[model samples]
Target: MSPTHFISIPVASPGITENLRKFQDLCGEKIHPHKVQYPSKLHLTIGVLKLFSDEEVQQACNCLSEFSAKIPPILCEQPLHGTLKNLRVMRGDNQFVKVMYSEFILSDDSDRLQNLADKCLEFFVERGFMEYQYNTTAVKLHCTLINTRWNNAGPRTINASEILSDEFELQIFGNCVLDRIDLNEMRADKSFVAENDKRYLNVSCVSFK
Candidate 1:
């Protein structure tokens, strides 16, 4: 299902943005600027919710509020620190890549972050929020840096085989802290493209305790 809304953890550190901006700038014309992810939009999505009405949206918002109060136990009163891994392509060959993202591997190689995401999804699912389902066993958290679907001026896929160079090092964004989770409303078309209008709305947010 296409997501009308999603629950995500914001990767808002300045260093993270600066690193991404530098890499995007280096790519220049090789990658469509239209498809490149804006620094402000970077986030690690947990899962999407298909809320079709105002009441359903409210229900999801309430879930965030209640879920946060219980986060201290799941997280042990600490924020999640994610180490940014190297850039990777999704779903296909590297020559015809469509989705390029940086995986956020949690600190100490522990499953704390993944477990937290699972718990949050279970919390909402039990409340009848109608979480948008995916084919994978679980939603993988990653920060998308480029997606060809967002650009119309070029072909559907880019030849990314040649660009994985030393210029883009592993863990480019370094360690990132995630202290807040948010529920944001997507655009009417459910696209992340910020062409002429705001791509997402900040409906609700909860900081970890």
Candidate 2:
């Protein structure tokens, strides 16, 4: 798959970003420096897509608008509030993990968040804009914190011993409040412009609030 774009909830809250930096500092000696995510690049992804042309990108933009318009007034008027309270391994395999992420604990109704994710995924997939491997019935919200892929050195997996220590077990990454969904560029381009220090190319964004 070309995998050009993805839908994501941007995380730029001041308290959250500051705490993320603190979390990274605590992890500095263990994980490779390249593997840590920049605070500006932090986000909770909804779905990935493969759009190959301008028309396709614009169509995806249209779909975002349509999806945003249909939301209920109660859910749409305010931000989707949540917290980053725990760290998790991808697929629960801590021995050989390519990704370590912070769990998103929604303070708002969990089912409402699930339904929103399901409906959003359904909207894009049914229209042939995106095909998500994320289960449509239950989508777990998470923001990736460490990725081994960025490390150019030998093995690209972090072992159990290399995982975060017990001190981080009850550690809170930060609180997240998101209202907008962006169809943004997944592949990084050096020539792209940055919006408020965000490096990704944003084709379109629709605010639920």
Candidate 3:
């Protein structure tokens, strides 16, 4: 069977998205323009489920709905504020990087966010939706700012760390409200290029007390 691709939630907010767009613009000027990610597609991945079947995906969605209801609305009292700071690269030993991303600093109530992620992983693993052996401890909640996978402009060696120096100013991109969990798919071409509206098979929205 083919491997199924999906991203676990905590999608970005408009404020964060706007900042991501600005960063993309900056990359276009400073780094390779082709490396930037689409503003609308920017998201913080919680986890990924590989080699899932269509039925398994549906089952996972159902589980998400149940899990979402249990997660209290995160940082909803006031808009959840987070800062986009620092640039890092995920590199393979082959001398090429897999992804480039920005580290986010959640203002407060971060424990709530981490707990939610832990619960999601626990649910999936317990139900066999995700592999039991998969180490959930390693999951870092982050957003991918640049990916080389879909870049048609070809490869280029650029040190993101060098381009983004400590002197570079960081800003609070935006406020986020964790109201929903989205279930998305990866296409055969290994890209989530489908219209964002159509790509989500299910969106589990939270109902806060």
TM-score per model over all chains: 0.86, 0.86, 0.73
Which residue segments of model 1 deviate by more than 4 Å? 131-137, 165-171, 188-199
Clashing pairs in 2: none
TM-score-better candidate, 2 vs 3: 2
Candidate 2 lDDT over 43-150, as tens digits, reads 878788888888988889999999987666536555678887677787756778788888767786555666677788888889997776744344567888888886
Better of 1 and 3 by lDDT: 1
TM-score of 1: 0.86
* Model 1 accuracy (lDDT, Cα): 0.77
Error of 2 at 144 (Å): 0.6
lDDT tens digits, residues 1-209, model 3? Answer: 54365545554667776676676666555456556765555566666676446677667777777776566554344444556566777664324565777765667736666666666667766777665334435457776777766666756655555445666554345656544455566542334455332233333334333
Global lDDT of each candidate: 0.77, 0.74, 0.58
- For residue 20, model 2's alpha carbon misses the true position, in angstroms, by 1.6
Considering only N, C-alpha and C atoms within 3 Å, which residue pairs clash in candidate 3? none
lDDT of 1 by residue, 12-46 (tens): 66777678767767776778877887767778888
